[model samples]
Target: QYRLQYKMTVREELYRQIKAHLDLIGINAADELFIFDGEADAEVYNRAVKHVDLWNHNVEFLEQETPWERPAVFIEFQPIKWKAIVTGVEYRADVFANLHVVTDWNEGDGIGEFQLLEKIHEVLAGLCGSNFMEFDIDTSMTNHNHEEVVENIETYHCIGFRHLK
Candidate 1:
């Protein structure tokens, strides 16, 4: 008999790497991070809003609901603000997460802990406008309100090689 490896395994590994990275920077991310394999939940958003500092931020490994679901995984972050967010807030699914060959992602799903640091750094720099590293994020978008902008840092999509060798 033959069997196939699940991408969730990769996603889970990736999550640990990312959580560790955040933790290295003095963040208690393990307790705040999560993974959901289906459609993004609005309840998570509600929980995030109700407990802005206590909700579980989520990550999802996509299986192609559309052409936009090409990335290895996507993350949903805590919104910047929570007031007057409207009854049904619109969640933008546009984001691009990648590293400029910072690490070898072709070996297997596991992209070692050290390499993971560089990878996560690149991703955060791209979408967060951090000058730590340079990378292109054309697919990225941001929402604003009166120039007192609070970016949506809770969500991110990590672009990675899918082949399991």
Candidate 2:
């Protein structure tokens, strides 16, 4: 007898792919963003990532009690509902998530966070992976924390699909 194996769900696969992409593009803790017309420069500048991980909803960091790195990037995934596409063989879902771009407001004249946000948005928006399609930037906003850390959350939307072979 022969059998086919399924590794992960659509949501998990989508998350993995996006995380890998962000890891590849890189997020640095640099003071100034060397914005140039060349793409290679951007890639090099992004390689200075300090912290990048999936947000665990840790309130300690938000309460200004925990001491974390200056610049960080966290990915938070929203709940997804999978719908049957071809009876039971295929599934599809509308994926949504936010990229939390965090940086210290006291660093580099207090605008590096926004610059980093722009670089992240450029690299992530419209990104197409194997299982997931292009990701679109839906909205973005800034929030100031008690620790003088500024966070720019960019919400992204994408379509995820899965198939059983």
Candidate 3:
């Protein structure tokens, strides 16, 4: 239970930080926005793609938040999941983060989307470091379909578990 709470806090903080960073980069709205419950069951590579399945041309929803104003970013947990290791009397764990940036391929001939993604990457990189939560990005795997392209960035955070407990 404590573990779950800790991870949730981390996720919320991440979401807040992302909003702040995007604000700094001159984006005020998004097409589809959500911080997925990382605990949800699904394949790591397919989670983001799955989330997009929910958005089905809701006019009101689109009026509320337009993706064209800003690209959509889906944040979820990786299937490898969070793991903890016992050491003598201490525990350490990793918080797995899987982020997907979904964009329209036709946006500015795609350069606009690429530029936004780069800014997002920079923002995420600045949020964590070698201090405790090591934010490493793994872009080796990604998914692209139709007008939407899903770019995956995985972050692994290792830290002393007691602090969270």
Candidate 4:
């Protein structure tokens, strides 16, 4: 299974910009916007490519968020998968790794880059799997409190498992 949490702040126009880009890429609003689940290795790679393509299209938005700010996105890939027991015996384990990408958009003298990076490291340490859960964190300006704002981040959690009896 793979999961992802994405956070970002953009002007209404920018939001429209992103939507337009998505449309241009043929990703319809009705499409499964979140939770990309797949069973095959090729499927997994395709899903990740889709997300990266979207991000590339909106790379300008990140740049606009902070003037003269170079925000680098880092993703930690963690793979996890489920196994089934058959004939009173357990079969081989299915493996996957979760992907966690964290960056700083604090835009102040609060925390150092390394410190922010460490926060994600701590979070990734707790996750285990070969099926990756990918998370994209955009810590930018917001009207809501820290916890509330963090919760608002869009997350795409996916699972790819098959058990046969």
Candidate 5:
């Protein structure tokens, strides 16, 4: 299992409420979402995707169809904000999970780069998970060339989890 972390700046009361809900749903106090049973990396990613999807679906339904029974929009917004935070954590988890699998495929050799990319694409397609439109692996320079390296980097079709809503 992987441990994910997401930092949020919010009031203590609201944070406590959010933490309570997360706990109620089985998320840990450490903000770690566990992947049980030694599941494959792809399986873990799929589970994370499902968890977010279900939460969002329930929130949408409650907001639209049963608004009266729930807190007012303003109050509910606090939890929504926290949900977004959790979703962002999940997104990062998915990316890093794929990266770990890819890098491990060939002992981090450059030879398996293409195969790793293919595996990422396959997992994303099959799970209907967040779209990872593009990514790049840099081998040209180390941390010493930070300034020069930034110029050579490329990013495309990388949508933020916020926009997915």
Candidate 6:
């Protein structure tokens, strides 16, 4: 007899993929935003990533003093819509998410924040894994919240699948 099994959720898998990709790329917040040629470098240096995690969508979350480091990237997922497929015990999920690129802002300079934001979009725009397909950017804009921090939030969407035997 066949049994339905839960391997992993789409949000979880996408989070893992995004983290892994950022880890492999090694984006540091201290580096210069653009090179001399007026272009953002995809691989600036192999500095440690300050922080990357799932966001709770609370603006006040960043307002409070916390241990979070600069050049952080937060991933937030909306409610996933799942539909049962005709294939035995198979389901498809449509996922919508937002990536928040956070960096230090000082004295009217936001180069680092912009650079990291573009790099993230380039690397993750087409990311695909075992549980999900390619991700596409829907929209993005500057998010002004905390005084010392600057953020660029980008929305993305993808389709994922799950099956059981």
lDDT, candidates in the order shown: 0.29, 0.69, 0.44, 0.29, 0.26, 0.72
Q: How many residue pairs clash in each candidate?
A: 4, 3, 2, 32, 0, 0
- Flag the better candidate by lDDT, 2 or 5: 2
- Scored against the true structure, residue 3 in model 6 reaches a CA lDDT of 75
- Candidate topping TM-score: 6
1-165 per-residue lDDT for model 5 (tens digits): 976764432222332332223222211345334333343533433222111111222332332543321111111111222234455344321121111110112233444334323332333332222333232232221111222111111111222233322
Per residue, candidate 3 scores C-alpha lDDT tens digits across 61-95 of 44465544224555665433334454344344555
Residue-by-residue lDDT tens digits, candidate 4, 1-165: 866654231122222332232222221244222222334433433221122112331233443543222223322223443455464343333322222222334555434434433433333333323322232232422122332111112222333223332
At residue 52, candidate 6 shows an lDDT of 89
Sorted on TM-score, best first, the list reads: 6, 2, 3, 1, 4, 5
Model 6 TM-score relative to the real fold:
0.77
Off by over 4 Å in 4: 1-57, 60-111, 129-165
Give the local distance difference test score of model 6.
Answer: 0.72
Q: Root-mean-square deviation of each candidate, in angstroms?
A: 19.9, 4.1, 11.8, 16.7, 20.1, 5.2
- The predicted structure with the larger lDDT, 3 or 4, is 3
Residues 1-165, model 2: lDDT tens digits = 977776776556656766655554444365454334456766556553467777775423666446556467778888878889897798878888887777766755766667777766766778766567878889898876546667778899998877775
Give me the displacement of residue 136 in model 3, in angstroms. 3.2
Global CA lDDT computed for model 4: 0.29
Pairs clashing within candidate 1: 77-154, 77-155, 78-154, 97-159
- Those runs of model 2 whose alpha carbons end farther than 4 Å from true positions after fitting are 2-8, 24-46, 59-68
Once superposed on the true structure, which residue ranges of model 5 sit more than 4 Å away at CA?
A: 1-110, 125-165
RMSD of 6: 5.2
**For model 5, where is the 10-residue window of minimal lDDT?**
148-157
